[model samples]
Target: LLYALLHLSGFEDVSMEEVKNFRQWGSKTPGHPEFGHTAGVDATTGPLGQGISTATGFAQAERFLAAKYNREGFNIFDHYTYVICGDGDLMEGVSSEAASYAGLQKLDK
Candidate 1:
């Protein structure tokens, strides 16, 4: 999936060669993505529940910006934050904390 996303994004460092060399020494693509090292990744993420925690903050920021900027017919900051989690991710305490925070804040977006 990362290879496909890199392919679609056409990120400069993620060449076809880079895709083939993914996870190898010195390759731009690592086993886990490194944000800022890559152009397309929004946040540094891994297999754990970190993605949920990061995404909660990201979505809250988006919501705040949307509320602050968007006028009746002049929408500016509009996009849905998407997260896909596995059973392991959900089992993590950070994920539960993030979920509870989202619920408490009513972060519907």
Candidate 2:
């Protein structure tokens, strides 16, 4: 599903073939989406909690950039970071910790 979304976002390497070949050795669509290995992936994450932690980091970076560069009527860093997770992910302590930090920091975007 995510590989298809990446393809829809216009990343050429995430084409249908790669999506179909997911989890196969030598395929770009590994079980864990790697930053450099996949053209559109932004981080190298392992388990569910790790993915949330990485996303929180990205969101933190985005917030920092927005504060530093954004101005009235000229927003330079207005993009957002997004993620999806299952019930199992929420059960992880790391994910909860990352979520708590993001919430406390008000990293809504």
Candidate 3:
């Protein structure tokens, strides 16, 4: 699946390296969430709420990047985040914590 995505996204133009040979850390493609892990995946999310937390961080980062990069003419950072919380996610304490914070921050859309 990863190989297919890389190829579809024009990564073939850059390099055709295998993932296992990729370094453990500090490599562009780390074993996990190295930001440099892949061209697309913004953050490595394996844990229950890690993805949600990273998503919240990305939302915050987008706000900062928009201010830094997008001018009045370009509102590129305008977006929304949709999280589908299942029974499992609701049962997780981390998800509960994140949801509480989001509610306190009035982040509902």
Of the candidates shown, which would achieve the greatest TM-score relative to the real structure? Answer: 2
After superposition, the stretches of candidate 2 with alpha carbons farther than 4 Å from their true spots are none
Q: Assess each prediction's global lDDT (C-alpha) against the native.
A: 0.83, 0.88, 0.58
lDDT of model 3 at position 38: 64
Best by lDDT: 2
Query: Cα RMSD (Å) per model?
Result: 2.2, 1.4, 5.4
For each of the candidates, give the backbone clash count.
Answer: 0, 0, 0
Worst 10 residues of 1 by lDDT: 1-10
Question: Which residue pairs in candidate 2 have backbone atoms (N, alpha carbon, C) closer than 3 angstroms, thus clashing?
Answer: none
Q: What TM-score against the true fold does each predicted structure earn?
A: 0.80, 0.90, 0.50
lDDT of 1 by residue, 43-76 (tens): 7777699989988998899899998999999889
